[model samples]
Target: MPCCRLLWRPQRPNEDFRMNKQDLSEDTEVVLLLCGRFGGEKQEPHQPLSPREYSELAKWLNACNLRPSDLMTDAGRDALSSLQVARLESKRVEFLLGRGTAMALALERWARGGLWVISRGDMDYPKRLKRQLKHAAPPLLYGAGDKTLLEKGGLAIIGSRDASESALSYTRSIAARCAHEGLAVVSGGARGVDAAAMQGATEAGGYCIGVLANDLLKTSVNRQNRIGLQEGCLVLVSPFFPEAGFSAGNAMGRNRYIYTLADQALVIDSALRSGGTWEGAVENLKNGWVPLYVRTPGEGPGNVALVADGGLPFTLTADSTDSLVDLFASRPVDDVQSGSDIVETQQLLLVPEAMVTAEAVTAEIPSEPVQEKSQPLVSPEALASSPAPQPATATEVLAPSEAHASGDAVGTVEEPAMAEQPAQLLSCLSLDMYADFSAKLASLLGGGALSEEDIATQLCIEKSQAKAWLKRASEAGLVDKLKKPVRYALGRQGSLC
Candidate 1:
């Protein structure tokens, strides 16, 4: 069953991540030069800057109202010469930017091989990356096939590369069920559980997303995947290069992408205290990327421990699970499960990099596993690509002080007088963020309705907050409130204008 491959550098693909210019937008080209490895040189003199380094540079750019693309221009070059950014030398920036030849060669090769790349700043970039992971989002992503499949959120089925046969069967069944329900089944595209899951879904003629840790070039052209790729039913993406090899660090880093990309994550199996599965699940819990579910009858110690750590325990039997949509049905955020309850939820919003504080990039994350991370959570403007439109009349927001009474709808609690509320609780939200947030939220619902749980999960906000946002969106006529299951769908567009 061709399980997930282990850490081994392939001798071929001949040349990997040799980037290029021309086809790429200036922004992406600049990003690649600054952060990408141009696939040559045993010991290159000017190593690319890291994400944290790029972030620090971004802050300076935003401060000066300059973009990365601007750096290539004479005016931007003058600003670089005249301005002093801490810890960054003008020469260092120049050296990185000088790799135009390497960039062009790499891109040309990658493109010829049917690979494409997108920068975080691109509107086509997955909104989930911007909203869920925020600045932790990768600067560049390389992939093969349709990029739109990346946004069609579905369950992220993750497990050990060495999962047992029974667990593999379960993963396959679940993936197939998701396919039958018209939901995309996302996985690491590794061997073992990952392989089984994708196989099941694609075999069932269902769409799937393969978020690979490495080996995209090989995977894209692999005989087993060629049919799916050709059918436009599969998308394989990587934060690393298309021709990059497997590294344990890359494996670990890739897990966050899987979790963030999905509506929810389900662990079919996991190793205890180690492996990419364990580390990724631990990180997801700390970050609350989404409500995770561990297989109920799994043998692995990691599965047990994860449930104890607050993962929802779920059981999916193939025949009984015809529809995956029910799995994401609405649930209250505050009325969370007591022990092991199933939850059906997912959603996310985009944040512009300029709003993130410079210090956040400098803060070190803990080395060991921790239940909760200290990083500030991305506020739940869920799904805004740009600022939401301000209506002629003022619309209310779900402030911290406003609490839900009960159920999914905004509970009938009387609003507290503005005078009585704590100053901090009523603090103003960035109007641009809110506007962008609403427009994005509208876009998300434009397809189908979503529950409070779905909104909360995607936006990375509390469920109560999702309920509040829905109520406000409903009032503004941006979204229509549906009863019975209590979901919100796109409202009249003309009404907003």
Candidate 2:
């Protein structure tokens, strides 16, 4: 088989055997070869193997006790076939041959670039991501600079690409304070808030990890960034091709890496309706990946909304780094694990379906149901027991003499029924005056699912008010309450409103 032939390749007399093995295992050369070849890099809107696919493949490899290089063997093909992953038969031989042709060039480029590649199986891969994201963690991480920096958890400073000067300044100040307390600052290495945070940490002579979405090669060698790299205080990493340009999807995908690598996350600024910053913050909140914080007296509606949603308010003047550190220390680490375990269990249950064609798997999943906002604002049971209202066309006013002559039944109505009329009347009133507030609430919910506490923080309203509005909207069929911890999402009518 192919594995036997590769094992017999002539080796140089002076070549170090340990170095050769290290190159194979630590650099993920075999997996990279497979990925470059039959993994379909030429496909439009290129993407690497999805987290689910990687997890499935990993499970198969473990079950068979085979290394990535073994995949070139006949036995490997047999093993892969047994797993019944979709499209395996059509691509097996081509994938193996492609790996053979690309392996040399890939190794050369990686060596020349001074890059280190970690696959999911590698010991040095970030355990935090695997623990938090589980099957959703990236299969490979391409990095430059010190790899050990990834293990040192720190604060993640995230915000908008167009953050205000005041927000940027606050990010810098907080990052520097984190540095003084011997903490690293993690960021996406984009412009605005990301840049400010990284610069602050490095300038303070502290470590930082820049999780870049693109331009990893260029950013690693920049004159400004080079000093920190040389000092072994900055590490730049990416899951995308080193030379690839920025992509909206990639930018969003990398946000999770930033949040996962850190113990906590701080949002400096975010737009109200939508933005990467807002989306990432909301996602982190839902996923419970880390402790989320938003700056107090925020720069925009998004920040305020996030704070209202349950994000802790972070005030630079009022809060000190030591206190922040103490707060983090006091929190139970197991709380995070508990949240991740529930999500992981849900994902694990879907692995079998995920092994089928992607399209088929997606087709099997049902969409979330939406509630209408114009519907009755009371329960069906209450509506059933209540009296029917007069028709709109019955506009003629009845005289008391006519009512008595006709033996009107109006006087027979009970006082209790009259008392219930006002509530029903109020429920029927037009909510147009609160349209702006409803729209803003919908925008926050639409960004991503949130809990009631999150809604309260995001709207800067009392918990009771937030609950009342949510209940009213829900009764009007405007939002949905998802699973445990009770996340909220915009219903169809709410999204339109």
Candidate 3:
């Protein structure tokens, strides 16, 4: 019934024609309806496609360079008659003509907030995803968490949902190390290893996210270490509706998303011919995306085969931070080394008039007690009548530029210093040209519009460092972060007055 809704958007214009076709055969009527019917029910239930419906679909598939096998059995055609063929072509036209009915449902969620769509061409879509799509590309993606994380390279760690104790320990270690190196770890949100990796990032004070196979809301039932998610330490996502339950097919489909979400995939441990995770690895290898196989003392020969076939070794104890740092440092330095426009912009951002007004409100005004009449000889009664002066806290409303300047002077310059850095150095940074990026930063902060590429270019900092800066700014009553390539913006609260 709901699937019918998916097909109805474009068919409204032909409703009269459909209504007039009372004499149409059952097979022709079904084909004209363009509904996917199960193969088993076709003959046994006396349901069949007209020869024409069958032939036209075959032609369409051939034209698309696909076989009839490309579509699901439910979508296949049984042979159709001559008249049915003409009707089938019209039905095919209707199927292809459908409007936004299916899309509208997905879009409604996004419009209501907490939903995002990542199509194939979006720059924020992970490049790794593009690599995997070459083999088994998804139609569309709906997810949560920092979208920019997709752009900032990270390592994917995955393993059995029913992992053993030793496997989990090793998985946790690798995940924590990756987080410490400022790399986000990606995994399917099953049990065991996935949970371990997410918790590891939380413990390490780093960001991590889970890609789920089931409807995110249903599978999140036993999400034990949810402290991380609640605290914005980790991201959780699923392609299905939040209420959808688990299915074997969906679980296998999840492997693609996990691999697609990362720059490299690290298989901690897996059995031969395990679901698509292994298949996904082979697919990834074919696509030239690197696969990292961890070497365990008891790992089977299959892992060795993987290693032999161009899969790289993921040495957990190696200089992970150095490797990640180098990766980040290798990013283009032009954003920082460019021209004078940035310099002027940085200076303007330092002390805009708005910031001055906010600061003035916080600055204390000295009180001048009314000049007492010449009754200085008055006793304790006069002293008791005097009002006591209340102590005021020192307040400062420095812009990002000012914060950088002061920060540089103190030699405690960390990423995104509020008002402390050399003007020249500050000029190199890029900022969003919002009417006000700091408006609601105090209440609903942490979502920014910066992509990983945008951040890489603007901050002229390593990916991890940019994330750290965003995290700090988010914590400090500054910005708001939205899921999916987590962009930052000002919070709903006014400011840190």
Candidate 4:
């Protein structure tokens, strides 16, 4: 209702006022001014505007053609009289004037600390949060360091602040592996697992996105973190004020930001009953925002329950860097098994013709009516001679075999020809005719770089469809063709868009 209260600290008499009003956008300056005015004071209750309140305010501003600064003007007062939220009369005007008067000093303080802010309307706000949280996303983000890192999705490593040394070590190793794979490491910027993961990623010359709940101004310039920040490998951001102290509610709420910003999440250790780590993991699983992984044989009961309740188990080895990359980069499967659990060696079996009895063949047939052998789907010679079929129409939806059958006629052929001779025919098939495969193709391309083969394997689409999607993506400037063999990476414009 009051848009939250501000607690102003007295500036030293000799403190330099280096920041000017021009340093920030008119909108941002006004928001900060409002925050400075109404935000919590020392020993006073600190009640920041709730997401719903922010949404309401945004709607009012839009409807009334009022910028935040307009609220302090004569016209603003007239407009405020018409808005329900600002109808409190004298008190509202008084508060607005108070904050407006302090705007200069507030800007100076923020500038002195090298602090910056992005409102929800800003283009630089993390797209992931905008997509995942939508209306509930933070209205403002105060941050420091490389803002571009926010655009790079990565693995989120989260756990208790007092995690076991082994758990922390596991997190660091996984983070390092993620770095080796060219992924950023996302964390809550807390102690133990979060800190270990961030440190590991930066130490490996990889990027890290730290979503801090409080004390962002203090933490961003920490001696240990300064190098990474300066190197553009670390970005620390928070939804709270730069000087806001730790609040349990803020910490728990910030977990969603960490999870939503990441491509996937790993839980090292969580208490079974409660705690920020446990609650966050549970909320993430419930929302299905990302694929949640819990360390197997984890240090706490929470791990066992999480796995039982659909959390995937992440088991890593010293040499599993490639496997780890694939795990996070690939889309999640219904089953919770990791790639490392899959055996790669192929097994060959020798089945004698005699082993396939007539009864066995008959049993394999579906109970549904089958086309008679007399009317073969496609005689071998006919398939070879016929031109490739045109894309199917909606009413003519047919399986590959059926489509082939309807196209041409020829004499029946031997079984071996039927099994091995149609490679050329299948290659000519147009996968665009299938809508489901087309959608999957688009999804895979947006996720990351993929060779045609990778798309086929990952999306379970046909090779031809994968190739077609890659070509389409290239044409649309959504992907770039790379090197020999033609792998595709998301195009610069594509990532920015």
Candidate 5:
């Protein structure tokens, strides 16, 4: 079933629900206890755990074979008092978890305002954030509107809040083009370029996902957003308090969400050296989260330098807006950044306690053109990219000592291997180098059949990468491709039952 079900839809006033602790999932409630500030316009009574601190706590809990929900139980509470975890102070941990009253009151208010909260442990939490950001994924998310829209990948259009008229016009046109192509527009929902892009898409009857830094409660009831919410074309989410005011730190921190949530991002405008737009674009380029595209011809002061820093340049105008889809078609894999989840644990669960340490990884597959391969499973060739180059004439070399033992002539030789091979081939790296990367993948599948998204989240790789590897493995008879729901498992295991 789709995770975002309509629990309620009032014909008038639009008050959605009343989610008390009993109605909340155990993981969700625990996450709220650890990270939520839960109140409108009230001073924070206690410090919440930051991402790093939460990660440490998670690891410690995992080591103890305890889930976060376990901490809420009487026996689990008793165990916590007897246990000693250096990363988590007993008093602080207890204090945070004791905020059930505050959490309950806050949840009641949020639910009444047509708002909903999801924890990282919730199956509905945005997979892009967890897959791309890994442990840095926020522990909790507060949202309004159709949460389903969060997973619909689209073009993220970003720029300065005070962008020029030409830039704003182009941003709107490009966003409208995206809508025409049935794409969602992702943005920070701030004024200027963010607002302009969302406006263009909405006006064109397109979907959008907004990652707000603050004021989620107010936005939930904004008349302009009502139609979009009713039609399930928009979802506004925040990592901060719903009624919280905006701050510079919050704005900058939320920039990563805008980039990771999209398949591609366009820098409509940005100044050189500083500003949230510039920093976010620069960080995204360095992190390789997605292909960062900057506006050309109408390049901002920092646009040229952004391109120099690995941002792709594309020209988008009223005349060229139709090329939006073509622009997103190319996502080159460049550098591997840590936050990009180049390697990590099996992230099948949003509950940090359920996460396991990833097996050490030595493989780094480059995203390159594939040549014709012999195996034909899904199609005519293994990778099915480019035509392979002509192989050079074979050369002869002396046989190994094992051949001598087999009564072969001492000077007997064998032919050399093919001279030309596709860069995408693991053999190009070394014979059986696929083992380097395939171990974790095969291990994950060893349990049972799983879909592409599951495998990607488990192996902490991009969904595209997971799909490519699964296809190759299936062709090689290393994995069994199953029908019905579309899943995979190690074929060598002979299709479990």
Candidate 6:
């Protein structure tokens, strides 16, 4: 028997809502009072509540003697005892029955588990977000990618939606560099700079995550960024449910998420008082986030102001790539200024440092006999063109016999040359002690002898440095470093040993 056969048709609104239409303004006042009790404390009248009318609901909740715990079901007491339960239901009815009915569909998707929420007070919430947790903080967040990305350190790069071509190229280059050095990237998933950054990370074979203001499935208004999301190279996240539409307030609300998801913020381009990227970076700075400002030679006063006010300035030129790589090598675990702070954490992973060995690194000199081309004597024309040295004074000039004796006294150029050769060798030798040591070890090892410990003992260098140099030589195709007691030998397919 189908239970639906006995379904009672819902009465039309005009029939059931027959109560006197007294000043409905009074009903709104009552609703406002109820909102005040449920929401905590008084809210300024000018700052209206969210669609649910939680603004003044705190007063009504207190008047009703309701606590958050009251919402939980106990052995006997059930959800009906909860003011929150009643308010949520009533608000749902009001919205569904009124002009803003579309939001209910979004709420339905959320309730159906297609969405999950992170509240401001939730422990899983990002601590950095707490700084913006005042009235501006989003009440809840929804996400799709690794939620942990929100709590960990990452870099944020942003710029104008109408970004110039050069700006996009610069953003990609910097983002790729940052990602190659193992930093995560966070951005608003906007069309220009943000899309370029996310694309750059993907191209660099690095992970990049996107934060969106609207639903994951919906295309961003600037559809260029949408293609990246579709390609699976980027992760799209949003705070609103799948059915929610894009709105200005919703876009503004995502500003905090952009800043909170990153430890450092980079603004590639933005005007003074720029609503999107610049404002987010400004908010991040106030809350102690490190800001990286990128500027062209003449990007103008806004970038200058940011640089003057403690933002680290960087030029988006090819020459700065090495410096950029060094910047990205940093882990967010330490303060940006003191590179030493990272050493403690880094020391846990021990890899030998390469030692520059004398033999392996040296460029080979030609072994075959050298041939010399005969030099022509200075032409009479050339000699005539050259300026003659000033004639020596009578005291400066030596007698003919005296000049011959003086020439002999001046000594052989070959003698001086011979004297300088050993010193040059010694100086070259001094530059790379470890390399020289490794060559000796390689000779011993290639002869099918000598343990790494033996080489270390003979070389008078640390075991690690010895092994490192030997390994480096091997890597450079100079020698073979075998496992177990780690011995080094000249490579079988050798270079000019």
**Against the true structure, whose TM-score is highest?**
1
TM-score of each: 0.63, 0.62, 0.43, 0.60, 0.62, 0.45
lDDT of 4 by residue, 12-125 (tens): 233443332224555665565444432445443333345666667767888888877566567776776676774234344345445543455554556565566777767777
- Which should have the higher lDDT, number 2 or number 6? 2
Instruction: Point out where model 4 deviates above 4 Å.
Output: 1-22, 36-48, 65-75, 86-90, 333-497
Model 3 over residues 70-97: C-alpha lDDT tens digits? 2323343222212243445434434432
lDDT of 5 by residue, 1-497 (tens): 11111211221123534452225567777777787786531455457777778777777778878887877766667777765655567777777777666666676678676888888888889999999999898888888887778999899988765565566667778877889999899988765677778777876789988888767777766655766777898888889888776555676788899999998898875654456777788778767888887675333445544554566656555776346676567545463223212111111101121221221111211121121111100111211233431111100110111111234444413221222111111211122435445655644654566788988897778898888877876664445566666777554211100
Instruction: Give one digit per residue, the lDDT tens place, for model 6 in 70-126.
Output: 322141133333435423443442322232122223323343332334454456556
lDDT (Cα, tens digit) per residue for candidate 2, span 121-220: 7888889888988877877788777878998889998875455455566777787788888889998876567776776676567889888776665565
Which candidate, 4 or 5, has the higher lDDT? 5
Provide the lDDT at 465 for model 1: 70
Each model's total of backbone clashes: 23, 12, 51, 8, 1, 20
For candidate 1, give the lDDT of residue 159: 70
> Between 1 and 2, whose lDDT is larger?
1
Which of the two candidates, 1 or 5, achieves a greater TM-score against the reference?
1
TM-score for candidate 2: 0.62
Off by over 4 Å in 2: 4-22, 36-40, 43-48, 81-83, 90-97, 318-322, 330-497
**After superposition, candidate 6 runs with Cα above 4 Å error:** 1-116, 120-124, 131-137, 219-233, 296-301, 323-497
The CA lDDT at 72 in model 3 is 24
Error of 5 at 292 (Å): 0.2
Error of 3 at 216 (Å): 2.3
True-vs-predicted CA distance for residue 27, candidate 1, Å: 1.0
> Once superposed on the true structure, which residue ranges of model 3 sit more than 4 Å away at CA?
1-113, 121-124, 131-136, 219-232, 239-243, 273-277, 296-301, 315-497
